[model samples]
Target: MKIYLAPMEGLLDHLLRDMLTRTPGVDICVTEFVRVSGSLLPNRTFQRIAPELLHGSRTPSGVPVRVQLLGSDPACLAENAAKLAELAPMAIDLNFGCPAKTVNRHRGGAVLLDEPELLHEIVSSVRRAVPAAVPVTAKMRLGYNDRTRMLDCAHALTSAGAAELVVHARTKADGYKPPAYWHEIGRIREAVTVPVIANGEIWAVDDYVQCQLESGCDDVMLGRGIVADPGLAARIKGLPAPDWDAIKPLLAAFWDDVLIYILPKYQAGRLKQWLNYLKRIHPEAGIAFEHIKTVKDADVIGAWLAEGCPVPAAEPGWTKA
Candidate 1:
């Protein structure tokens, strides 16, 4: 089974992608969506979102990274995909699953699901424009507001030449709610000829098992789950889970990487954002975040982590959803 890292906007940037792809069982990493508008974007824009494009489109550990594009316009998406293909990424993934209001307001993400033909046109245009050796894929929610016409949408994407399809198992209106509707993916898989990857709310190995059983798809993609437990992908692949001590070095490495790549003013917030997710899995992370949540100084945060933020004997249960 292929385990992919979901492209979460604002969270799964290239820094985190580099970190997670180093872990075992992460087959591929998808960069956060590069928003396409009226015109072709410059090469610098693609490089900014996926700097790995400079180094054979693979993470430091040699895991492939696919560039994902989000837009509604067929010609513009094709133009951007053609330009990005020149960079030789592992694959091109089209984003039809984003639920952010800002993205939808601009006719960019899940909102396009309301018109299956539009989704087909956009995907087909990108598929034809890029080299045939470069695979084109699409990720989509069940629908815009409901599951009706979901089969139509699935068939539309496959007929449009998407090499693979990832179904997030919820409509745009569902918006990250409980019960990811994994069984719904089974329907899409049956309808389409292309491979379907299941994604949504897979937080643990048990959840991964259940998602596969329910969706009947061999491939799975993880998002927030990896943040809550950095060793989750390793665990899913039957590797030993990283204990608190093992996790500390990764946190330090992440801090160092962010400090080097990101500007000073934004570094602390990125660390804090990761801590917020880490708190769900480790007691030490909770204590660390509480103490430095308001601190904007990355140096101070680094000092605290370097000092070994005291870990209590017992950790709180994972709660965030």
Candidate 2:
């Protein structure tokens, strides 16, 4: 199975991607979307979002990282893609799955699903702009407000030369709710010729098993699921899973990176955001989060972490969903 790490805007960036891919079983990762509005963005813009481009489009762990672009204007996207291709990314991915309101108001994301023809134009345009060796992929929701045009969108993307597709299995209206409608992904998989990677609502190993059964897709793209449990992908492949003892050092290393890269004011929030997700798997994470939830000083939090911030055994059966 090809397990990909999803591009979570504001949540997963290059630094976090580096740390997460250190574990085995993560094959590839897609960077967060770079909004292409009108003009061709400078090389720095692409490099800023995905510094891995400067390092052969691979993370520190050596996993290839694909750059994702979000926009509606076909010509503009093509121009930006061509300029970005100069940096030699592993691939270029289109973002048709974002559900944010501001993005939709600008006619950028899932809202574009209503017009499959436009999706075709955008994908085909980018495909022509980039080199043949660099693949073009796309991620999309079932639809904008409903699933009426789901298959039409899928067919349009593949026909326009999308190498692969990642379907989130929910409409824009669903908005991160539980029960991600994996059955819908199964239908799309049957309809599309290229590989279909199932996404959405996979939180644990059991969820991954059930998603594979329901979606009938061997490939899966993980977002919050892997972020919450770093050992999730390894567990799926029956590799050794990292316990709390393994996580302690990671937490400290993460804090060090945060201090160096993130602004002093927002550094605390970044660590807390990750810890909030970790709480879902390890109770010890919840304790760590609570201890620093109200503390804003990075040094103070760093001190707490240096003291070996909570490392208790995971609760019995924490490995399962």
Candidate 3:
């Protein structure tokens, strides 16, 4: 019955994490992956990426936010994991499922799946480095280009001391396409004794139910689906859907939080990134975004999101795509 929010690189920063965790049914929020290289990451960089760790490693509303690290080098990755463990977030999550071109080109993320022994080394090194009380979990796809070694990879990670595994159910080649191949996750769940969390192509309540039923997993991690529907996780848990009017106020409140917390420090590009997701809830919100499309100043974008977007209807099922 656990629900973890997937750590989407650009999409699930602190602003969105704060807003979503405020809604019902969210338990864990994994921060975006911190790319590790030859040495320990700068403490300032880790703090900026996951300031919630300062607030007790939890969301403002108190849901725990786990820190995630991405890298392929066993030694360096393990070193960074140790430092992150010192900071002490709820858990340390390893990212082996990112399919982004740059990460794959660097032999990090999902591309590491190509070599099962290497994946084992990476996971085991970090798992042993981190404190025993702090769980070290991993997220990964089936493979890079084929499904030939999916189950074996899952077994490798679990045997290497990964507390749990989140399977995105697609190979690196699938690249976020529809039909997330949930069956593959089911297969992985059957193969591993560690907890398996299913991810990908989950956009609605039925999708959540089907994922759990099909994968035989006790938990599900949501990404783009929750982005499209702010109240989605709540709805999937059978909570009353926020009326359009109620949600509009909440959105406005969320914008206020964004303006107060994120705008002054980050780029205007981040504002647009958030609006693109908000558009899924309030299509009209895009109009406000269009007005500021050419504006590069973060202050201006924050102003627009705060003052420009029209109030959305409060009734459920307000508009259809």
For TM-score, the strongest prediction is 2
Evaluated against the true structure, the overall lDDT of model 3 is 0.81
Q: Which candidate achieves the best lDDT against the true structure?
A: 2
How accurate locally is residue 27 in candidate 3, as Cα lDDT from 0 to 100?
77
Q: After superposition, which runs of candidate 3 have C-alpha atoms over 4 Å from their true positions?
A: 253-269, 284-308, 311-321
Model 1 Cα shift for residue 18 (angstroms): 1.3
Query: What would the per-residue lDDT of candidate 1 be over residues 70-101, giving only the tens digit for each residue?
Result: 99989999998999999999999999999999
TM-score on alpha carbons, each prediction: 0.94, 0.95, 0.88
| Candidate 2, run of 10 with poorest lDDT | 312-321
Error of 2 at 110 (Å): 0.6
Give each model's clash number: 0, 0, 6
- Write model 2 residue lDDT over 205-274, tens digit each, in one string: 8999999999998889999999999898899888997877788777788889889888887888899999
Cand. 2 TM to true fold: 0.95
Q: How high is the lDDT of residue 315 in model 3?
A: 21
Taking all chains together, the TM-score of candidate 1 against the true structure is: 0.94
List the global CA lDDT of all models: 0.88, 0.91, 0.81
Error of 3 at 141 (Å): 0.5
**For model 1, what is the alpha-carbon lDDT of residue 274?**
89
